[model samples]
Target: MSKAYVFTRNGGPEVEALVDRDMPTPGPGELLVAVRAAGVNPVDWKLRKGYTRPGSVPQPFPTVFGSEAAGVVEAIGPGVGGFAIGDEVFGNPVAGGYAEHTLLPVAVTAHKPAGISFADAAVLPVAAATAYDGVRQLGLAPGATLLVTGAGGGVGSAAVQLAQHAGVRVIGVASASKKAFVESLGAVHVEPGGGLADRVRALAPGGIDAVFDLAGGDTLREAALLLADPAALISAGDKQLVAELGGAPVERARTAAVLVAVAGLVVAGALRTHVTGTYPLSAAGEALRAVEDGHALGKTVIEVTV
Candidate 1:
C-alpha cells in the first residue's frame, strides 16, 4: 500500500486529505517512481478550494493534488526505454506526487543531475519551467532591461536568476521584506504599490524591453502599460490577462518543454533550486496552510519517505 494525498470533493484545504491506498503499477509507456520529495505550489490549494477552471480537472472524485516530484525509478512499464530500476529521476508526473509512490509518463521524466539533491530537483519542474517559458516568450536580448513583477515568489525568483543569466537587466517588484533577496538575484527591487511604474521608470527611463508578470493584478496591468514597442510579455498566472495581451495560454506540452530546458540547466550548473521549507507527508495540511498564508520564502516541499 502507498499513501497519497487525494481530494475527494471540491472545497477548501479541509476537504482535501491524505489517504493510504494500494500501490499502483505503471502502464505502458509509463514509469513508477518511489517519490522522495514533492514540491508544493499555489495550484494545489487552488484546486482544492475549487478555484481551478473546469477544463483543468482530468478526474472528478478522488483526484491527486501534485504534479512535480523527484524520486528513484522503481519500475518501468512495457516498451519504456532509456531508464532502469534504481535510476534517480525527477519530473512532473500526471498524477499526484504527495505520496510514497506515483506513476508518470516516460516522456515527462528525466535523469536527475549528479550534483543536485532530491529536494532541489523536485523544485525545478513548475517554478523553473514557468520562468524559462516566460523568458523565452520575450526573446529578450542581452543588455535589454526586463521587468519582473512578483519578483520574490518562486517563479519570480527563478525569472530574476534566468534573466540575469541571459545578460538582461532585471527590475524586480517585491515587498519590503524581500527587497534584499531580489537584489541578491541581480534585480533592482521596486516596492509594490501605486507608484510601482514610476519607480521602474526611474530605474530605466526609456522603459523596459520585456515584461514577465508572475503576479497578476494591478502589477500586470502596469506591465502592459510599460511595455516597449514590439515588446514581449508573458504571464504564468492569469490566462485572461495573457489573452488580453495577445499571449497564448500555457499548456501541458509547453510546460513540459520548459521543464526539459530547466533540467538541462540544472545539469549544466547554470541554475539552482531554492527550497524554503520541507514537511513530512503527514503534515501536508500544515504545508498547504503555510503556502496559503504566504509565509514560505521559496518552494515548500513535502517529503514522502515512508
Candidate 2:
C-alpha cells in the first residue's frame, strides 16, 4: 500500500489525515512517480478549505493534497512518450501529490535536470511557472521598472528574480524582516502598509512602468494607481479585483516547454529555488501551516521518504 496525506472532506485541518491506500496505476499518458518531494503553497490550504480553482471539476472525497511534486518514474502508462522508467522528472501531478506514489501527466511533466534537486524542481510547477507567465505577460523591456507586492512570498520571490533577469528593475514590497532577502533577488525592497503608493512614488518619481501584484485586496487596489496605463497592471493574486481595476489576470501557460525553460534556468544559475524549509511527509500538516500562516521565507517543501 502507498501512504498518502489527504483530506477526507472539504474543510479545515480537522479534515486531514494520513493513511495507507493501494497505489494508483498510471492512466494513459500518465507516469507513476515515486514522490521524493512536494512543494507547499497557499493554494494548497485554500483548496483544503473548499476553495476551487475557477472551472476546475469537483474532486472526490478523501482527495489527495498536492499538485506539485518531483520524483523518479516507476512506470509509464500506455500512449505516453518521451519518459521512461527510472528517469527523474518533475511537474504537475495528475492528482494530489502528497503521497508515496503519484501519477503525473506527460503533457506537463519535464525531465529533471541533473543539476536540479528534487526539492527545487517540486517548487517550479506552481510558483516559478506562475512567475514566468506573469512576467512574460507584462512584457516589460530593459530599464523598465515593475512594482511587485507580496515580494517575499514564493511566487513573488520568483517574480522578482525573473523580472530582474529580464533586465527590468524590480521594486519589491514585503515586510521589513524580508528586506535583505528581497534585495538578494536584485529588487529594491519596500515595506508594505499605509501610504504605500506614496512610498513607492518616493523611490520612482517617474512612475512605475508596471505593477505585478501578488497580494490582493487593499494592497492590489492601492498599487493599481501607480500605473499610467491600467493595462500595465496585472495580478496572480485576485482575478476579480484585477478585472475591476481594468487589468487582466496573469495568463498562465502551464506547458512542458515552460517547465523545461525553468529547469534550464536553474542549471544556468539564473534562477534559484530557495527552499527555506522542508518537512517529512509525516509532518505535512506542519508544512502546510507554515505556508498558510504566511511566515514561510522563500518556499517550504515536503520531503517524502518512500
Candidate 3:
C-alpha cells in the first residue's frame, strides 16, 4: 500500500487526512513514479476548498493535494516511449503528488537534469513554467521595464528573476516584509497596498513597459493603469479582471518541451528555483499551510522518504 495525504471531501484543512491505499497503475502513455518530492502551491488548499481549474475533470473523494512532483520511474504504461525504469523525472501529476506514488503523463513530463535536485525540479513544472510562459507572452525586450506584482511568492519571484535575466529592468511589488527578498532578484522593491501606482511611478517615471501580474483584484487594477497599451498587460492571477481591463491572460504552453526548456535554464544558471522550505511527507499539512498562509518566501516542497 502507498501512503498519501489527501482530502476526504471539499472543505477546509479539517477534511485532510493521511491514508493508505493501493499503488496506482499507469494508464497508456503514463508513468508510475515513486514520488521523492512534491511542490506545494496556493492552488492545493484552494482545491481543497473546491476550486477547480477551467475544463478540469471533476475529481472524486479522497483526492490527493499536489500538482507537481519529482521521482524515479517505477513502471511504464503501454504505448509510452523514450523513458525507462529507474530514470529520474518530474512533471505535473495525474491525480495528485502528495503521495508515495503517482502517475505522470508523458506528454507533460521531462527527464530531471543531473544538476538540479529533486526538490528544486519538483517546483519547476508549476511556478517556473508559469513564469516562463508569462514572460515570453509579454515579449519585453532588453532595457524594457517590467513590473511584477506579488513578487515574493513562487511564481512572482521566478518571474522577477527571469525578467532580470533577460536584461529587463523590473520593479517588484510585494509586502514590506519581502522588500529585501524581492530586491535580491534584481528588482526595485515597492510594497503593496494604498497608492501602489504612485509608488511604482516613483520608480519608473517613463511608465512601465509591461505588467506581469500574479496578484489579482485591486493590485492588478492598480498595475493596469501603468501600461500605455493594455495589450502589454498580462496576468496569471485574475483572468476575468485582466480581460475586463482589455488585457489577456498569460498563455500557457503546457508541454514537455516547455518543461525541458525551464529545466535547462535552471541547469544553465540563468534561473534559480529558490525553493525556500522543504517538509517530509508526514508533514505535508505544514507544507501546505506555509503556502496557503500567503507568507511563504519562495517555494515550499514536500520531500518524500522512500
Candidate 4:
C-alpha cells in the first residue's frame, strides 16, 4: 500500500488523516508517477471545505488533497505519447499529489529539467502557471502600469516578477510585513486594507493600466477603483465579484505547452518559484495550513521520498 494524506469527508483540517491505500494505475493519456514533491495552495483547502469550481462536480469522498506534483514516471497509460517510464516530470495530478504515487495527464505534463528541483516544479503547475497565464492574458505593453493584489502570496509574487521582467511597471498590494519582500521582486509594494486606492494611486500618479488580483472581496473592489478601463482588471480570486466590477476572471490556458513555457522561464531565471515552506507526507495538514491561513509567503510544498 502507498501512503497518502486523505480526507474521508468534506470538512476542516480534522477531517484529514495520513493513511495507506492501494497504488493507483494510470488511465488513458496519463502517467503513473512516484511523487517526489507536491505543491500546497489555498485551493487545496478550499476544495477540502467543499468548494468546487463552477460547473465542476465534487470529487468522491476520501479524496487526497493536492493538485500539482513532480516525480518520476513509473507507468504509462493507453493512448499516451512523447513520454516513457522513468521520465522526471511535473504537472496537474489526475488523482492527487499528497501521496507516494499519483497519476498525471500527459496533456498538461512536462519533463522536469535537471536544473529545477522537484519541490520547485511542484509549485509551478498551479501558482506560477496561473501567474504566467494571467499576465499573458492582460497583454500589457512595456512600461505599462499593472497592480497586483495579494502580492505577498504565490500567484501574486510570481505576477510581480513576471510583469516586471516583461518591462511592465508593477505596484504590488500586500501586507506591510511583506513590503520588503515584494520590493525585492522589483515591485512598488503597497499595503492593503482601507486606503488601498489612495496608496496605489500615490505610487502610480498617472493611474493603473491593469490589475491582476489574487485577493478577492475588498481588495478587488479597491483595485477596480484604480483603473479607468474595467476590462483591464482581472482576477483569479472571485469571478462573480470581478464581473460586477466590469472585469473578467483569469482565463487559464491549462495546457502542457503553457507549463513548458513557464518552466522554461524559471530555468531561464526570468521567473522564480519562491517555496517558503516544505512539509513531509506526515505533516500535510500543517503544510496546507500554511497556505490556507492566508499568510504563507510564496509557496508551500510537501516533499515525499521513494
Pick the lDDT winner.
3
Per-residue lDDT of 138 in model 3:
89
Where does model 3 exceed 4 Å of error?
Answer: none
| lDDT of candidate 2 over 1-306, digit per residue (tens) | 999999998888999999999999999999999999999988888888988999899788788899899999999899998898999999998789999999999889999999899999999999999999999999999999999999999999999989989999999999998999999998999988888999999999988999999888999988998888999999998889999999999999999999999889889988898999999999999999999988888999999875
- What's the distance in Å from true for residue 170, model 4? 0.5
TM-score of each candidate? Answer: 0.93, 0.99, 0.99, 0.99
- The residue-level lDDT of candidate 2 at 131 comes to 93
Alpha carbon lDDT of residue 162, candidate 1? Answer: 87
**Residue 144 alpha-carbon offset, candidate 3, angstroms:** 0.6
Model 3 steric clash pairs: none
Worst 10 residues of 1 by lDDT: 247-256
Question: Compared with the true structure, what per-residue lDDT tens digits does model 1 show for residues 1-306?
Answer: 888888899887667778888888999988999999988888888877777664565666787778789999999999998899999888888788888999978777778877778888888887887787777777778999998888888888888888889999999988888888788777998987887777888999978887788778777877777775523777777768766876544443434455667877877766766688899999988887887776566678898774
State the number of backbone clashes in model 3. 0
Error of 2 at 300 (Å): 0.5
By TM-score, is 1 or 2 better?
Answer: 2
Please give, for residues 38-129, the per-residue lDDT of candidate 4 as tens digits: 99988899988888888876778789989999999999999999999999999999778999999999999999989999999999999999
For candidate 4, the 10 contiguous residues with the lowest summed lDDT are 53-62
lDDT for residue 52 in candidate 3, whole number 0-100: 86
> Against the unseen true structure, what C-alpha lDDT does each candidate score?
0.80, 0.93, 0.94, 0.92
